[model samples]
Target: MQTASFVGFIRTLFYILAFYYIFKFLAKLFLPFLLKKVVQKAETKFQQQQQYRPDNSWNKTTTEQEVFYKPPTSQNRSSTKKVGDYVDYEEID
Candidate 1:
């Protein structure tokens, strides 16, 4: 009867060891797939949230009127404003 109890105890220990090793191997094999699934779920949630905002700007407008701009001649350019010419609001006051 003592031998039978010892054998049963050993069997239980063996099963525990076997299950632990199996779980360890399973974690190694399936960890990457589990992580990828989590990332895909997060990405899907992000894409769903993006539907809240519109693609086009609300204030966008187009004009039908034709417009023209005259190119500056050499004489007009000499009489016109230069880059260094700056006006100060403080100096005017």
Candidate 2:
């Protein structure tokens, strides 16, 4: 049968804390370098994909059609300026 002792308990606690701090320190030191390598790899992959992509000019077609707009000509322009009292009336109901 195994018996619990105060010394063993303290030793186990110290090991746990030591391991935790060591892991934290190592991660803090290496995480940024790992992330930078990952970003550079992704950028290189994206650039390679862009290089091999098909040209968009082949998918575009120029149409021979054209659109034109012209204002309508009115034969009597002076008659449109005449205003009467009916044009300014307001109803309150």
Candidate 3:
């Protein structure tokens, strides 16, 4: 019984080590994708700030609508016939 328990403990230890290394490997693979997404978002925000300048004496309405979605008019609605094509469920935040 003692020998069996020792073998089981070693097996559990090996499995834990394997899981740790597997997680590390996965993180290494996915970290670049996460960084790329963050960098792209930062670039977009920076560009938007430059483009929407309130101090530049521009007469544009600055009441920033966070999401600018064009509601489908009768002409567009008639053209779209798919069942799940033009449905907007989530709030446009």
Q: Highest lDDT: give the candidate number.
A: 2
Q: Which runs of model 2 end up more than 4 angstroms from their true locations? A: 55-93
Which candidate should be chosen as best, given TM-score against the real structure? 2
The stretch of ten residues in a row with the least summed lDDT in candidate 3 is 74-83
Per-residue lDDT of candidate 2, residues 1-93 (tens digit):
999999999999999999999999999999999999999999999989877888756566977888798888867646556565566668999
Q: Which model, 1 or 2, shows the larger lDDT?
A: 2
* Clash number by candidate, in order: 0, 0, 0
Residue-by-residue lDDT tens digits, candidate 1, 23-56:
9999999999999999999999987877565764
Off by over 4 Å in 3: 1-4, 56-93
Candidate 2 is scored at a TM of 0.55
For model 3, name the residue pairs that clash: none
Ranking by lDDT: 2, 3, 1
Candidate 1 stretches with Cα past 4 Å from truth are: 1-4, 53-93
